[model samples]
Target: MVFSTEAVMRGRGDILHGRPALVIGFGKLGSSIARLLQAKGVQVTVFDIDPVRRTQALSPGLHRRPRPRDRPDRRQPGALRDRRDSLRGEDFSHLRNGAYVATVTSSEDELDLAELPDVYTRTIVGDHVTRYRTTGHCFYLANDGNAVNFIHGASAGPFIFLIQAEILAAIRMLTREDLAPGIHEVPAPDREAIAATWLSYFNR
Candidate 1:
């Protein structure tokens, strides 16, 4: 969330302060991004296919909106338009100029590029970059519709050590003879032990 938002706001020259943004998912990562944007004073509108997730977003001060309508009411002025206009039935023609669209969904279908009108321009930001442009709106595909934090050639910083420790713990659990074949939780003791080991190493 931080990296991509920085890329768009700082690198791409899209000032997020006081601008409107549409976040298409409200899961853990989505909610985090929405909160971050809101903290920056961006008016955020969120949409999720799941009603429960939509309700969750509302608690964080995000405006909840239903799925984009198939056709936007064309009577509104261009500057007054909202995400519903740009995302109207998956075509981004009506999105407000200067607004941002960030899709943090696991499924690419959440913001299908093929559904976009053919007149827009696309610039390659990276090998797997999924950003697109129509007029003044900037659309960022959070990790190109994949997990944003798991992009290739990018480091997870110090958090990588913790993730490694958790994976090791999970492996140890799998090796245990008493463990069942189905999904199982990694014991808290194992996680604590692994975390302690990392902390001790880093303290040296």
Candidate 2:
């Protein structure tokens, strides 16, 4: 349900700003979400049970997060402590005190946090109910607690694209093409007008 805004708002106050963060999944949505958070200047620490996925994020420019499986001393600079297995355990102790706790993984071997009723899960469900609800299909749980986890889903593609477009559009408007080569540039007037348009879309 397009919850990037709510997710950021709920967790923004707690973001570490410059400190490292651990993102524990590499699925489509998980990866895209991680990229967005990283762009905001948070040091991202990613982990995936799949060796290939983990290795991909580890590439030189990708700044892959170090896993405990990797040699201790040889671990990457942004490597977090060994908390990869625990879903709701001390494995995340390092991030407990950090600004943000972005748990995007749902290992088959491990329990699924989505089935549980937590703050993060509730937030996601609430976003869905708010944005896309039908009289007969409207089924949502009340907000009871904080969403500690955000499981990935196939629908992430469209949502990710929406967020990326908005962010890139903003980046383009703020900085010229020469200043940010990879970023898309939207004319200043167009940007303001489009922003208002998007706001109206959501307001409806």
Candidate 3:
């Protein structure tokens, strides 16, 4: 697993030290990113479509920020809580101001990012599900994200994959070639030999 705990922490530290970061889709990667940011004295907020997971991973006073209910002067009537809960969507005004958003879910729905209101300057990241590549199959990288195809693995054994280009303009930018075919293949070696044994469990 290239996305190990240490690697995830290092990536989180890079963003935390650079700018204020927000993590969406709090699965393994998002959760780890948030915890690492918190450990390094960075403010982190988590949002997810799954309310149950959100409530579990992000509770009041769990981080350096304050929850709506935790503010002493801002108390809404009990009836308003139900109304507020019923209308559940992010107020994207702040996100529009350039909050970096990262997602770790398998969702390929473009609406999750494209529909954000006024979010013209936010950095967004999607996981492996966004682009899955296979051997001999051509692919095109988008302006937003790259394709990650599994090339070197088999149905029963471990292996690497290759990256191909579909669109010439995008391909030229990535490979610096004309409107020609491009192939990206990985070597047939174990790159994880130096990693701790715990990482192998993720592959399983």
Candidate 4:
């Protein structure tokens, strides 16, 4: 999701400086994205229902903690990274004009166009982007509100799949055979093994 956020920012020319960016869901993915945007000088706002979990992973900075109902305040977000996939068509009123909205977690229609308010214009803006103009506002939706990471969500890059599979296999292998361990971590060898697998695959 961090890489996804970076891709979105870079794709949009990194013009997010001093602009508000919304990150829905303050979990691992959303929090990481919020921090990255903040580091890049974009003012980030995170929305999460769980007060405890939301408050836990946030970085030491002035983070806005707005309740669900109070979201989409006066200042519209210039960019929106939705990890929670909770956006609706009615939510468009609070977004900045021409903001690129992408979902990081689910490859589902986070912002269903059918739910969009009666609009005068909807243009298919190239691959993976659709522009909709309602009244005087405009915004872009990536992959038809599907996840930006994998719009074809059924598949994943073989390299990433390899790493995740290897990690899971390693943990399974280690946990089943160890009895003298309680909370054993994947040591250097396991990490090196994973890296070696990647190196070999890349070389191949």
Candidate 5:
């Protein structure tokens, strides 16, 4: 969420404030990104293959829409758009000239570079980070279609460490051979203990 928000906001002026933003997935990370974008006043649209996830994305101010078609609504021609699919040039024809595209999926195939026309400009946003532009459109292939938060220099952050600790605890439990073979809940007491420890360290 932080990385996507930063990518859209940094050096782009206030583009996110009123622009239309699309998030391609609706998993934990994608949902968080959508919420953050919405909080910043971006009109967020989310697409996911999972029906449950798609339903979850229909929040108060966010939109859940189907993929774009060759013939889009002519009434809103200038609206910004985003997509997540194996790139086809025709898929981009519906967007307005200045629209921005960012892909947060795990496959570079999501936005094939070969599909881009030769008249585009490429800019390096960071080490191994690149964005392409043509005419009025900007494209950010977030971590080359991998999770944006896992970019080379990015950290998982402090909160993630807490989750990691919980996972480690779960692993330890599995090793004890005292449990069933199926999924099991992590006890609330264990989570609370970890949270208390984390809070104490954080407050320090």
Candidate 6:
């Protein structure tokens, strides 16, 4: 959210307002980004390989939407997934290839640079960037196609502590309580309480 809006689009209200954005995927992360972009007045059109997910996107936009049986939308930034054809060959000059979207997609096909048409020139730019001049446009590719979100180092700021605390709580529960031998998601009340406590303490 911060990277795209702040680093690329320059923020939600100013340049992005009323503009149309094509979101490439419709998973958990993608849905959230699409919602945020919509909230900021950007018209969002989602492209997902799954027909179920596509149906879900047709729902009235809400924070808590239903699952595949009823679940709502998702979004990934521009990604070149040949198998799904979500963002096939769509070259982006504005945003570098942040492969966070690649991690989200299940396609095992590797990105073949040879397939990128008419790339007459390639130049090493930054530690994580390579400049490629195509037939008529120049685009940048992030090295290893790794997510740029970690550029700030391993620390994901104070919000990560909230996740850690939940993990700790889960471990404690596992040790102290008898949970049924199956996958159990953390209950909503527990999550709400933890978030409330974190906000009260940290917002100080």
User: Evaluated with lDDT, which candidate comes out highest?
Assistant: 4
Preferred candidate (TM-score higher): 4 or 6: 4
Candidate 2 residue lDDT tens string, 40-150: 676666667677877777652345645554221212222222234434422222223212222232333332334433222123433312111222221122111122233
TM-scores, each model vs. reference: 0.56, 0.38, 0.33, 0.63, 0.58, 0.48
Over 4 Å off in model 3, which ranges? 1-15, 49-51, 58-96, 105-204
lDDT of every predicted structure (CA atoms): 0.57, 0.41, 0.32, 0.64, 0.60, 0.50
Off by over 4 Å in 5: 1-14, 66-138, 142-154
199 in model 6: Cα distance from truth in Å?
A: 1.7
The number of the candidate with the highest TM-score is: 4
Model 6 root mean square deviation, Cα atoms: 8.3
When summed lDDT is taken over every stretch of 10 residues in candidate 4, the lowest stretch is: 70-79
For candidate 4, report its TM-score.
0.63
Candidate 1 residue spans exceeding 4 A from truth: 3-7, 10-13, 24-28, 46-56, 65-121, 124-154
Residues 38-119 of candidate 3 have per-residue lDDT tens digits of 5655545555556675776655323222343211111110000001121112322222221222222211432233443342
In candidate 4, which residue pairs clash?
none
Tens-digit lDDT track of model 6 for 1-204: 424332323311225566555555567667766777678776666656677776776784522223332211223233322133333233333323331222222322424444455543777655545566655445444433443334435244788888888897788678756687887777788889889999998897
Select the stronger candidate by TM-score from 1 and 6. 1
Q: Evaluate model 5: give its lDDT.
A: 0.60
How would the candidate models be sorted by TM-score, starting from the highest? 4, 5, 1, 6, 2, 3
Those runs of model 2 whose alpha carbons end farther than 4 Å from true positions after fitting are 1-16, 69-86, 94-99, 103-204
> Could you tell me the C-alpha RMSD of candidate 3 in Å?
18.5
